[model samples]
Target: MSDALSKPRSTPGTEPKPPRPVPHSPADDIPDGAQVLLAVIGIASAIALLVWGIPKGYHWARAQDWHHFTQWAATIDRPVHTYLAAHTTGLPITAASAYVLWQGIGLGSLALSWATGATGARLTWIAYGAATAWMVWDSSPATGRPVATALAALAWTVGSAFALRGLSLRPVIVNR
Candidate 1:
């Protein structure tokens, strides 16, 4: 027999090499347009809340008498922060410094969630829209513009529902 024909292709103890893993591409990390839009809305909403909504809310909370919700929030906060007096009521913060801290933490979290494609930021924004709509509905009689309020609430609710469907939980990879 010829030398080529006489030799075996492989030894019994040898094993075949495994296939290589596919390389990751930057394109794979790009989110869909709707997702990006939702992220933008969340970021904008968070900024708006920090800039305007929180200040207004803080003032309102201060002016109002102790409600059940405020009582509950205070009860929960009291244990966590003993420095807050028992009488210190209204949505867990009685001082101007608290608003600053709240704004800083809220903005940082929203930014992180947006950057990471976390479901939390989207969900929180959707909740805010829904809550705003509910509040509009509740106060419509006083506004004396029931039709406009109804329409606004409808838009807010529907928009938030659609956005909820677009929420994503993946960690976004930035393409440098």
Candidate 2:
């Protein structure tokens, strides 16, 4: 027999190697243009919240209500540092500083989530829903419209859930 027929082509000892698995990439998992758009909107909204929080913090600080502001912030998951600072600082410092810290942290988180692609986009909406629910629950009594706030929160949660489906956990990549 010819050498080609008599010998195994791969090798005497080594078996054939399996092909390399394609590299898994987050960029490959982007769901669609809608997801990107939603991410942009989420980033924008987080930016707006940061801006809005600044003025509100300033107002509360001027009012000398660090204790009160801190209480509300705790409901919305403000970092522990805000609590420590609130205890140490006078109202003006606490107000401005807490706003910068809390909002900056929140916005930073949202921005990071958006940076992750489809999975991140879905996570952002889920986070937004939970945060909105917590904020509404915390503020409803003060706002004097518990029913309205509850309905609004429900609407927001539903809307966020609907938007979340725009992203797949592992999106099917269509090769053009």
Candidate 3:
């Protein structure tokens, strides 16, 4: 009672306290080496597909008289060699198996470009987006359910958005 009476009373009934500042989170921080490693892994994987997988696929397709017209070059989507894995026998390195590598050079270039801090970062997005589009088109069934292709496209789109956002935040330096 004495303390309350002696102390200056708040306006009417409300008492105002100092505003608390919002704390910043360092969780999003990524180390330079880690970023480089991630980029390298992505690039290397892509290169392996282009260098090894695509050539083998082309050869196989040629032997089997399948289309050899820029399969991976035109479109670099992942999750390959589905039919082979579905087989009852153990995974065999058949001609068809050679084409299983996902998102060949197209994806790899993008990774390398982003990793090395190369300029024109915005342009890489075209390849990033086109790959998903190509996959959607290639994977779509001729005349059946569209569930699988749709789901994959959706997932890829979300993933691409996240990756692109991460890249976009990077500081850009323009030469005047």
**Each candidate: how many clashes?**
0, 0, 0
lDDT of each: 0.57, 0.59, 0.55
Give the worst 10-residue stretch by lDDT in candidate 2: 75-84
Off by over 4 Å in 3: 1-102, 113-125, 143-145, 166-176
Model 1 vs. true fold: TM:
0.30
Query: Model 3 TM-score?
Result: 0.29
Model 1: clashing residue pairs? none
- How far does residue 128 in candidate 1 sit from its true spot (Å)? 1.5
Tens-digit per-residue lDDT, 1-176, candidate 3? 68878998777758887899878667448888888998999999999999999999989877893344444322323332333233424555652544433344435545655466444543554554555555455554555225545655565565555445555566899999
The runs of at least 3 residues in candidate 2 whose Cα sits more than 4 Å from the true structure, single-residue gaps closed, are 1-93, 117-136, 140-143, 147-176
Q: Per-residue lDDT tens digits of candidate 2, residues 88-168?
A: 475556655765664564455455545554565556556755655555555445564465345646665555545544455
Q: For candidate 1, write residues 129-170 as lDDT tens digits.
A: 444444444544445436534565555455445444546569
Q: Clash number for model 2?
A: 0
Better of 1 and 2 by lDDT: 2
